[model samples]
Target: MVDPRRAFALRDAFAQQVTRRLKVPAVEQRAYADRLQAALDGQTLGGLSGEYVVLVDRNANVQALFIYFRATPSDTWQMIGASPVSTGRPGEYDHFITPLGVFEHTPANMDFRSEGTQNDNHIRGYGQRDMRIFDFGWAQGQRGWGKGGISEMRLQMHATDPDWLEPVLGIRHSKGCVRIPASLNTFLDHYGILDAEYAALAESGKSLWVLKSNRQMTPWAGRYIVVVDSQRESRPAWAPAPGGKALAKVPAGASSAD
Candidate 1:
């Protein structure tokens, strides 16, 4: 077990860093760290193993998407990166809620990505061009999850419309998917976790990561997404000045599992 004092110090430092970069309030950062700790204690990743895991705290009220990286399965998870996101809103799309649970991100469902191009709506709904979509299959048993018309609820994590969605970020506004910052989406796509095979496939003019066998092994292949509910009811006043001011950007190609 990690030392309690070290953990608290790490959490405080992490909170300070997030506040400085994402402009989120100290309270919100702390709350997120706490929730992350709880999730780790519960072994929310199930039997999956990897150097990093994506954690979304619905309780933080879509304030940000937290990315944790560790040296190994036995090492403690640390806050390595983050991006502001908008989750499902209340009373929208049949009161569609972002389901909470452990999910695996597969390459099969990620072929269709957004290029930040404007739709007939004439708005950038899915971030800058070539932004990859990391799909985790269906959520809520494939209930109401589409954007406009009625369709199966396909829970996905991708970038959002900077002009419209970004402003309303850090809140419950998305139909069911987790809307993230554009740069973050690109970063995750360009350098996937446990994604060496996928990367190789892309290099050979093939852009797919379909799982063929359960015995396949990769050191960096956990790519797990764990969503947790908020413990608080309201947003902290100190969290980043809401309304999407374009938080600090985390440079791509900078990952440390250790």
Candidate 2:
């Protein structure tokens, strides 16, 4: 299984962290979680996190990504923080597909070369547009654009690259955006990546790992994945999987038993 902890963490933030302002109610948030879990319960690619807050969706090639994070004591992810990422699309001009999972990114990295002056202070972009997410819709599908000719990726979780396992669309897949966990997205946009700190957990060798879903949100551009949260025949059993093997590049980590 590919450990997301092994994934690259490029420093690109205008500030240090994202801002959170709970827009959804606790009841609504819990309801959302219930719906998400219900759909994922035994579904092919289900994932959970030590942290409660999580994001799910189809990546590319029918694969899925599970970005996880911990919510504040208030039972809100905003109280904790968020991250920035690229998701997959369903199909033709349909750029609203990404996987789901619990991840911890902080989403503080900001690229001023691209963001501009306005974002300089806010650690945002030049336009200082709040991508606090699933919040800003690009009209319908592809109308999500940015200011100063800066086009909006129109994604819930905005990232630099496309989260995929195999190839689906190169320069043509997404119309103008991707999607992410609405709350997480919002938080990341508020704060940018300033100086950061990370520590690997003692129980787990890797601190940052992606709990990939067996379900294909889209086609993975041609990478490998593993199941993080599921109840299936996967070696881990707890995290079900199929074609997951060790890669020459990744280190040997513990896996599930068949």
Candidate 3:
């Protein structure tokens, strides 16, 4: 079994690292760590045994996306990776806030990967090639996220055009979907998250764009994404804007997207 104290410590350490780039307060950090520890202890995130789990903390105002791996149902969760993301912007009628709760990944929703291609405007909205799109499907919220209705918000997690979004990561800017880095998106796609089983089948196909779907569940088929945000009133003072110099120094493969 893993040490609870150690796990909490690691969470705190990660929060501190995030605070350096984003604007998260120490109090909010402690609260988030405690909440995650409690959830893990309670085993509230249900899925097949040993399934991978993703935890997204929006409270830090930095949009921290943490990935954990487990070998068994009772095994200690291991923090394998993390990334900075941009989530939905807060607004009414059209722009909506990212909803908070536990969501299950279903193959019925996640069936395609969007290649980062340019539109008529010469903008690659989806980042690098072969970026996976994990569609949670029809999350209930206000109308109009990124082209959907109130009852059927096509909520998804996808890669963003690095040139357009890398500078704005760790902040809320997306219409509703989660915008991530090309490297991070590729990592998740290559290893599989919600679409692991289908991905394996696609590997032997003629083209990734026209691959068949296998929707089978596996030990490593992760299908849960937990999103929680801080209730704090003020944003952290250290968080920088999109093009600030403080953010420019981040290394290519560091927590921030390259």
Candidate 4:
């Protein structure tokens, strides 16, 4: 059901809008694609032929997210764009390490928008106002604090505070949710990159207030967010760590969703 022409156009738009890019080699792209297919199979979810899927490496050494598009279930996934992100950082109380698996973004969990309000520490927990929070409902995650056991944590992909935390996005800083750049947030929202269900509803004549009226939605809107940990011992040169003293000053428990 995906229009090939529109899918290509969306990829082009991704390149223009997403500023931070990760140059993943063709081989690595294939590997991630393999992983994505495996996760989907494990979860018993159908392969979304001609749809776009988001992949994230939650490894401590490499915190990056990728957008991939496939023309068919059997086709190779082409990398559309990549960006730096912050995954769960466990070491403090109430922090959970981001779970690894294929998570589906659906209306069952109900996505929400950030008010962009600052907490007492003067940090915008969910980035600026109107930022879309891609909710995946409660997921079992490894506890980063306490005795380090497993617990249920709400898994979400959203933008972090632009001024204070967005700069250090490459490193782990969130409680359990995935923190992304405001630009990437806008890119995903405006394109309905992961809004497959929302688009479907709209097509059925259901008006979703969350979807922007001026949006240029792709025909191949996807619903899966595949998270994997490469378990790399060191950071690769292509995925450089964030520099500056600001990395050290990232406040503990900065995420508001915890």
Candidate 5:
């Protein structure tokens, strides 16, 4: 029951916003025209479709996709990576509610190293350090939930389960990982076009391929804001790097370890 036209328009607006935030070249703007055409063709968006980046809003509930294709001119808006995830617990237990920004897949976090089955979200990549979070403590409201740590060992996309979809419907869920659902997890892990943030920028050459791609609780006037483009070698952007837990060593009456 949503307006797809408005959704596309909003996608363009926010894509510009995020592109400005990153401060890239103005010439890259043309890249969006092609992306626009592809979106109309039916690129649907769920993974690193072709060559692009994805943006999510932490300050707001918005998710957008920008297709950055360079190698071979393809008219398809591929879904890359995304943020604004509903991680951990919603309220009290959800310590790591991540923010909105550009994060990439690093070598250490690549989930393909494991010689086992990882049909879940942990197959994307891992974090630099254990990802600790600070999110709302309840299911619907926003209050500090103290802090918690998620090992840098599980970088996730979304969920691959239908039953596990509701919690992520603009609420909060997951255990400190970028999430999706069975509906779109495979596409995301399969494309892996956003192998690195730099590649993302190179894909677009400088513009954003915007689109309103999430089917969840969106409070934005339009649909959502997504930034699909590439970038140059920067600081790998800013990702949340959590520290060690600050819990007490032991109780006053408890005995010490050997």
Candidate 6:
């Protein structure tokens, strides 16, 4: 387990590194942490002592990723940092809704760096060259295309095209994977935030070329990314939509936990 003092220190350090901060309140942060714990418990992934975990709310109104850490299985999860992200956006052919639940990051599905090549549409689907792609292997997702049905899709989290895609990160717009900011990708990669398995392999003399040579890894390296949908009816002030405005209005009787 991580020392409590050290965990707090790491939290502060991570906060400073985030380029685009999602200013969530303490109560909301705790609520997201509660959801993370629930997902872990549902998947029987408890006992992850002193580990950091990435939590993403796939709710369209709140396309945000939260970094959380806990010193022990029974300890309250504390927020490290948060940033805007783009999850799966349905309605388009070949698009799949981002799956909900806990996904473990392991060496079984090795990660790779993006080639930074633009597609036919001149869009860099995987951001700049050398950006690490956090692969979670194949996952069954609900297809967004015609005659929609469950199908196996490759799950990955990486930086999106900086010019076009990155600016629209707060909204859902991906082919099933999670798209984050390039700065956040570098932060996660440089700190080994979710590289627990890779670190373990490297410690045993296994060379992982994907890892950055100058990475300052944390002892609380995490392996899990828990995704949940808050099902908010409207956008919250803290989580603004694309143009920095809460465009969606909250209807009467809607929950305030947007």
lDDT string for model 1 (105-223, tens) is 65655546665676555556566666667778766632333453434567878777665556556766666678776666654554454354455565578735332223223234345
> What is candidate 5's TM-score against the reference?
0.35
Write down the worst ten-residue block by lDDT for model 4. Answer: 249-258
Order by TM-score, highest first: 4, 6, 1, 3, 5, 2
Cα lDDT tens digits, model 6, 1-258, are 445548667667667776778899989998998888888888877666587889999999999999988777778888888999988888877788899988989999999999998776667788899989999999999998899999998889999777667777788878889899898999889888899999999999999899888999987788988889999999988898776433243122111000
Ranking by lDDT: 4, 6, 3, 1, 5, 2
Show the colliding residue pairs in model 4: none
Lowest summed lDDT window (length 10), candidate 3: 249-258
lDDT of model 5, residue 161: 24
Better of 1 and 6 by TM-score: 6
Q: How well is each residue in 135-195 modelled by candidate 4, as lDDT tens digits?
A: 9999999999889989999999998888779888898888989999898999988888899
Clashes counted in candidate 4 amount to 0
Predicted candidate 3 versus true structure: per-residue lDDT over 152-185, tens digit per residue: 4567887766665666677776666777766666
TM-score of candidate 4 on Cα atoms, chains taken together: 0.93
| Candidate 5, 153-206: lDDT as tens digits | 223443322322322223233443443333233333333333443224435664
- Cα error, residue 33 of model 3, in Å, equals 6.2
The regions of model 1 sitting more than 4 angstroms off are 1-34, 37-50, 60-62, 141-152, 194-221, 244-258
Taking the candidates one at a time, how many backbone clashes does each contain? 10, 69, 1, 0, 29, 0
The model with the greatest lDDT is 4
